[model samples]
Target chain A: MTMKLWYWPEIQGRGEFIRLALEAAGIAYEDCARVSGADALIADLDARKGRAPFAPPYLDIDGFTIAQVADILLYLGDRHDLAPSRIADRYWVHQLQLTIADLVAEVHNVHHPVAVMDYYDDQKPEAARAARQFREERLPKFLDYFEQAAECNDGPWMIDHRWTYADTSLFQLIEGLRYAFPRRMATLTPDYPALARIHGLVADLPGIRQYLASNRRIAFNEQGIFRHYPELDDE
Target chain B: MTMKLWYWPEIQGRGEFIRLALEAAGIAYEDCARVSGADALIADLDARKGRAPFAPPYLDIDGFTIAQVADILLYLGDRHDLAPSRIADRYWVHQLQLTIADLVAEVHNVHHPVAVMDYYDDQKPEAARAARQFREERLPKFLDYFEQAAECNDGPWMIDHRWTYADTSLFQLIEGLRYAFPRRMATLTPDYPALARIHGLVADLPGIRQYLASNRRIAFNEQGIFRHYPELDDE
Candidate 1:
């Protein structure tokens, strides 16, 4: 039997990163929240007791559970041959994944600068200010680093021309940023040719192409992490 | 030869977490930024063109450079036997380290809520609100989870009786929070006795005790991740 993954049913949010990886690898697993209801998701999480994850997108397999997208990818990468076999290379890819995680957190913060629990309406002013910094400073900074990384490698992938979890994640980052800040990404696209190439390469992958076209992949919305706020986007 | 660790010279920021783990394990390494200068640190980092770290607190050892605190520690934890030997236990430890990383990022945001590049003075009102949420909700929530984790374990450490990098990180979290928000921590301290016990155990570790007493351990200040601001604290 395939393992069970638990996350919020509505938005792609952080869970989409995991979904992309699983789909890209053609791995089998059940998204519990989609099959069951959100209440079941909460109840299942609450029942974990002492070892509960701080948030969702956690995977339960063969009686062991793992959370943190990078950690999950780290485990899955090694098991399914998604990452390099060498220790140094593995750590390098994991480091990149952690950087992606940082970028994701900052993306979420742009919408909820004052408080995560607070709604966008309540924190619109702070969000506007944060969004400015993110679009003007952080977005370019993160993309430039990744573009340089991809260029340094011999091929479109992040490491040694191979499709590591980082490559899939970079694709998601680009896609999510485009969804959330279409105008800004359009303006900035010319500067990140390497990232653009990698994104294209990942999009062409058979599994990803199928998954993206299918209903299993959720749409981006205000409820998600990378929300498309028109006020938040700028050239 | 010992590894070379690069970070800011003046403050105990993210680098201190790595420093604490290495110190707790009695691992020898040169604090490159302290010996050389902030300029030298910048030059060294800038020179790693292809895969440079997004920011500081990176480690260069045996010709391999690793960034991200948790990744560096994950690499070190296995070689130095600071983490568990089993694969499952190792991933578990890494997951905890990732969670600690999340908490560390949130702690930094409390002081610079509106912008990372902006001074606290410019975002005082926003910082005040962010700090309140952090101190009242986030700090307790994170500490509570870790406290329950500690209680579930057989000993004072995060996993089975042996000390791991997670234990060292928990120590840094507690110490940093106390320094950054003394009054807030004092009020909330009674609720997390397991974490307190883990902190005490880590403090008493002979190697850590020696390192703490030595001049090598940098003190907390305004420049670091955990900064003291009277306005951001509440009883």
Candidate 2:
């Protein structure tokens, strides 16, 4: 049976990460929320037996469910033959993924600076200040860091020419940043040539192209993490 | 030979979490920065090659160093027999640890809403708004989560009265919160009695007592992750 994945159906949020990777790899899994409702997702979590994922974006393999975006992807990477074979390379793969997770947290904080529970509307006053700092300082700083990592590789992707979970994650980061901070990303897009090159290259992969075009991938919107607020953008 | 730990010399910062656990476990390790200097800490990290720790507070073991606070603690937890032996129990250890990592990031952000690179004085205006929301909403919400987890066990520690790294990290979290927002924590402290219980209990541990009294443990000063700004604290 295909694995059952549960999260909010309406928005991609963190769950989309699992969705995108699963779809890209052509792995069989059910996005439980989309099939049923958020209630089903809750029931699934409540029904988990031992050491289940703390929250959604979890993968239920056989009967075990795992959480943490990087951990989940690493699990899938190993299962579906996405990760490198060597132990050291796998460790580096996870390290790169953790860096991606770091950027994801920062992206969310652009609008919800102090608390995640509060709406961007509630935090709008703070978001303006955060957005300015993010666009001017954060986006470039993070991009530069990733760009350096990419340069560490002999070619494209985080580790050599072959794609790893980190590459897909970096691709997601690029797409999300472009969506959230288009004006700012536009200004710095050409600067991160390696990242820009990988951005274009990942789309050429058969699985990624299918995933991007399919309805499985939710379009970027205000409800999601990388919501583009024009006022928060600058050249 | 004792393991060599590298981190900033002056501040407890992230290093204290590891330091406390090691000290509490009666494990011996040398503080690399104190014996050497601040430059040595930087030099150690600079000299580390290939997908090493992103920054300081890394431990040098068998010629290999790893970073990330949670990862580092987990490393010591396994080696020092601090973590659970069972895989399932250990997963819970990591899950709770990851959650604590979230709170740590939030604690740091109370003062660095704009950027950590910028001075707190420069970001004080931004920090005020961030700290207000943090104290009013985030702190209690996060503490409530930890309190619930603490209640999962029968006793004071996170898991079955065992003095795991989670307990030590929780101690630091509580201490940091108090230092950062004394008046706010004073008003809110009563609500998280479980966490406070755990806090007081961990402090009384023999190793913790010795470490606290000894110069080995760094003090809570303004330069660390937790800093008290009177203007940002209120009932």
Candidate 3:
């Protein structure tokens, strides 16, 4: 049976990370929410119990369900043999994935500074301060960390020449930053040579190449993780 | 050969999760930075080249290293047979661990709201707002989620009569919450009976019980994730 993935019907959101991996591996799965609507997604999530997911972007396989972006990615990696073989190396790959998760959380926080319950407009003033710090401090720190990771091996992927989950995640990170802070990303891109190279390489991958061109790969819009606001994108 | 774990010299920081797991498993590992000083951590971290850990609480087993708290716990769990035998069950345990990590990050943010780089004093106003929201919304949301997770199973553990990594993490979360928000935690404790039971159960594990009583488990302080500020804990 095909696994069911439930996420936002329109934007990629956190689900894109899992979708990209499934696509890259040539795996077959139903994009349940995207195929239907948000109502179906909510119903499916609500139907689950005992061991149900805490939030959305959950994957249903057999009788079990799982959530958390990193958890999903790691589970897929292990099942597909897409992660590192050596235990220690696998640990490192997961470490990178967790760090990526942390970055994604912080990226969301920049807009929802006061609380997730508050709107971007309500927290815009606080977001201005938070975004400045994110653009100045975290973006650079996270980008540099990925840059260093890419440089670990001679080729573009984080682990040796083969593409791992971190490569796809790094690609998303670069893409999100570029979409969210065009001017700032333009200024910062030149510094992270290895990260840029990895991003470019991921785009050139046969599976990623096909997926990006298809309608399945949604556009980066304001509703997505990366939002473009001129004020938030200062160089 | 034994593993080498490096973290802060004092307080049960994020690194303590790794330390607790290692101790519970009766694994022999060196606490490098604790034996040395903070300088050792800086040098070891800085000396790492490409694909290095983003921060501390990294374990070096032979030449390979790993970072990220939940990732570390899961990796060690897998290697040590500290997880459930079934794939789906193990996945649930991981999902729970990631949730704890999420809560841990939120707990840290209550004290550092404006910018992680900015001083605590500089971010007091923002932190106060954040703490209010966190206490009112986030803490219960997280605690309720964990309570549900614990209640899913029949026993005290997250899984079927096994002390998985999630149990250990919840124990740490309780300790951290108690240290950081005593009054708030006291009022909130009765609301999460399952989680409180698991916390109390974890304290009874031979290894964990010994670890808590021993001098190895450092006391929580202002420098750690949980800090007691009378103003921060008021209901």
- The clash count of every prediction, one per candidate, is 0, 0, 0
lDDT of 3 by residue, B141-217 (tens): 88888888788898768888878877888888998898898888989999999888888888888899888899888
Candidate 3 — which pairs collide? none
For model 1, residues B1-235, the per-residue Cα lDDT tens digits are 7999999998889999899999999899999999998999999988888777988899988778899998998899878888988898888889889999999999888877779889988999898889888888888888888888788787768997889999999999999989889999999899888888889999999999999999998888899988989889888
Our model 1 lands, by Cα RMSD against the true structure, at 0.9
lDDT tens readout by residue for model 1, A1-235: 6989999999898888899899999999999999998999999988897666888989999889999899899999889888978888898899999999999999999988878777989888999999999999999999988888788887668997678899999999999999999999999999998899889999999999999899998888889988998998988
Which structure among the candidates has the greatest DockQ? 1
- Candidate 3 lDDT at B119 equals 73
Which residue segments of model 2 deviate by more than 4 Å?
A39-55, A60-65, A74-82, A121-125, A154-156, A160-162, B43-49, B78-80, B154-156, B190-193
Better of 1 and 2 by lDDT: 1
lDDT of 2 by residue, B143-187 (tens): 777787787777667886577888988999999888888898888
Clashing pairs in 2: none
DockQ of each: 0.78, 0.31, 0.70
Comparison by DockQ, 1 against 2, better one: 1
Please tell me which model should have the higher lDDT, number 2 or number 3: 3
